[model samples]
Target chain A: MSYELYYWTGIQGRGEFVRLALEDARAAYTDVAREEGDDVMSAWLDGEHEGALPFAPPFLKSGRLVIAQVANILHYLGPRHGQVPDSEAKRIYAHQLQLTITDLVVEAHDVHHPVGAGAYYEDQKTEARRRAKEFRESRIPKFLQYFEKALERGGGRHALREFSYVDLSLFQVMSGLDYAFPKAMSRHDVPLLRALAKRVAERPNVAGYLASDRRLPHSENGIFRHYPELDA
Target chain B: MSYELYYWTGIQGRGEFVRLALEDARAAYTDVAREEGDDVMSAWLDGEHEGALPFAPPFLKSGRLVIAQVANILHYLGPRHGQVPDSEAKRIYAHQLQLTITDLVVEAHDVHHPVGAGAYYEDQKTEARRRAKEFRESRIPKFLQYFEKALERGGGRHALREFSYVDLSLFQVMSGLDYAFPKAMSRHDVPLLRALAKRVAERPNVAGYLASDRRLPHSENGIFRHYPELDA
Candidate 1:
């Protein structure tokens, strides 16, 4: 049976991470919201469907299991799709890296919606300016450096000994960061991550997905937005 | 063998979630930073150790494995400590609940540091006021209602069919919220969560831990801070 993935039908939000893995593994799955409508995703959120309740979207339904939380979902998929190493220790390490990525993603999103998600970016422009400055100057460099160091430790080829979901997610993050903060990212130097992103982008499946209509472009509506005022 | 938990010395922060589970399970573990010093924890962050580097502290070292991220650490500990159900489905449900708690915790912390963690709360007092208003009025109730519903689904006493780390973490979150925003929390009604918190506190091991010096008090230094002006 094909897996059913439920997320909002616009600019690759958190759901993109899942899509990348599914595409890379050549796993047969349905992007339910995109194929149908937001109402289908809303039904799950409203508890009209079975399985577990997700606090938000980007949930996966594989058979009877309904998994949420990007890292949690990836953790489940990584082993199944041969995206992680066999050893338990290495799998734990990959997850820790992914969780750190999750933290960075939250920080990146908060730059545009610093005050609260309820308010529009125009309303919170001033707060976003303050947040964006910190994120660009300190936070981004800090996270990038960490990932670069990890990549170096893992032989500078993949996030681990071999290709894993962490590499795919990192590619997505690097892509998002490039879209969101071209100016600031240009100043920071992360040679290993740049190469990894390049390699991930060139992967046959990923390259095909990028060239296909399935891939969505980043917009102001998504987590990683290119706000000229927010970018230094 | 005992586990070595490395977190910042004074504040509970994210480390408290792990601490609660260890205490509840009566697991042998050392709050390493509290025992040794911040330098011991700083060494791990600096990557002087052999294990995988954590982006920050609140990492647990067991045998050769070093697990970071509160939810990830709890996921590891829950199974070994028998804090989760024996079945895979139940454990995943428990973890999904824990991750939701993680999201709520981040939002709660951001109320004080909306601009960025690099700046002081005093410098961002005006921003905190705005963030706190949304947090108290909207975010907290939404999360509380979700947890209450989850609790109702699992059987009113626990976050799962049996007592698990999710319930323990939920108790810690409720206690922190009460300390942070007593006025706002008092206004919202979540009978199931309130009852679960009370029951968790009465657990003999947890009650003992609460009375001991090991459990730190909530303060401005921690994730959940009570600023009278930010409250109400």
Candidate 2:
């Protein structure tokens, strides 16, 4: 049985979070658009006959059943992939953490595109400057505190601390944050969270993928981009 | 056999989502804050608690384990309580829908808060106006299209064609939107979605919940507020 992932091929974007989970698990799958091209992604979503997948990017097709949402995809891949725990409770807990990470990801995306995703960041620069400041100030602490507590509550060691799917996502998010707000993150002094990112970076498969060509470097095109003005 | 639901007592807020599901199942549960008071909600989260129940309110406590997140709480309650299906694939699909609902909830919240939840909506009114327009226009259609397709894809007249946990969420979201933006909703004729909302509203358990004092009425304090200005 083959697995196919449909997403915007180039930018790490939302799909990267799913990719990290699969890459870390060494799961067999195809990044459909990355290889086949956008016509495929477009056709895959808006083809004739009106039969399209649910939502957009980061959908996983396992046989006939197609699943969307980044957290949902990871939740599906986690158990089948051996990346998440075997226990039902543990799995659900990991999913909760992943969902929280999704919250953080949306916040990051908004820092740049506070007006509208369809509109250019330049078009929304005035509003974005306002939104980004608040994001760096208020949201980071509120969301991160919730997560730091989740790590603490979920047994704070790693983001998952027990080799769960959420940890991989936490790593990806932290990486994105680092790319986007290096100064802010450095000043924040979240030592444990930094350590957690370092630990996930050291994972054998993840580390291998990071070093290999398959992994894309964080860039301005992605959700988390380094804009010095926004960071401050 | 006792269920304890933990959430901030005062604001019906996100906790209400969980309340709707439990009430629909007609399950026996205690709103912990309602019984235990505000201090208990704070104390439950305080302390160097690792693997603590959940990151925030709207958590469910069954004996020793504390389940958190509205979606996660519902996921835990769905199968055992019969709000969702028993099959693993169906369960995942149920979760996919809930996660999408969660995203929608975030979007709704962002409309008022825009950049910061800690700040007042009036403070962000300028930004809110811009965000609200996008929410009413773009986000509504995007989410509606996906859910409408999911209902269609479920291969029956009903969504998931059966009463799943997501069906209630879809119904609730539609209710929230209608209340929040009656003018906008009235202008746009989303017949498929409107039909789904009606079906969910007429469900035996849900109908009972809406009639009972147990279900909180839609208000300005919650995610979907009926602000006339934002409606247009």
Best model number under TM-score: 1
| Number of the top-ranking candidate, with lDDT as the measure | 1
For model 1 chain B, give the 10-residue run with minimal summed lDDT.
B42-51
- Position B108, candidate 2: lDDT: 87
lDDT by residue (B11-55, candidate 1, tens digit) is 999999999999999999999989888888777777778768788
Once superposed on the true structure, which residue ranges of model 1 sit more than 4 Å away at CA? none
- Give the per-residue Cα lDDT of candidate 1 at B98: 88
Q: Which pairs of residues collide in model 2?
A: A153-B51, B158-B161
Query: Scored by Cα lDDT, where does model 1 land?
Result: 0.91
Model 1 achieves a DockQ score of: 0.85
Q: After superposition, how far is residue B57 of candidate 1 from its true place, in Å?
A: 1.1
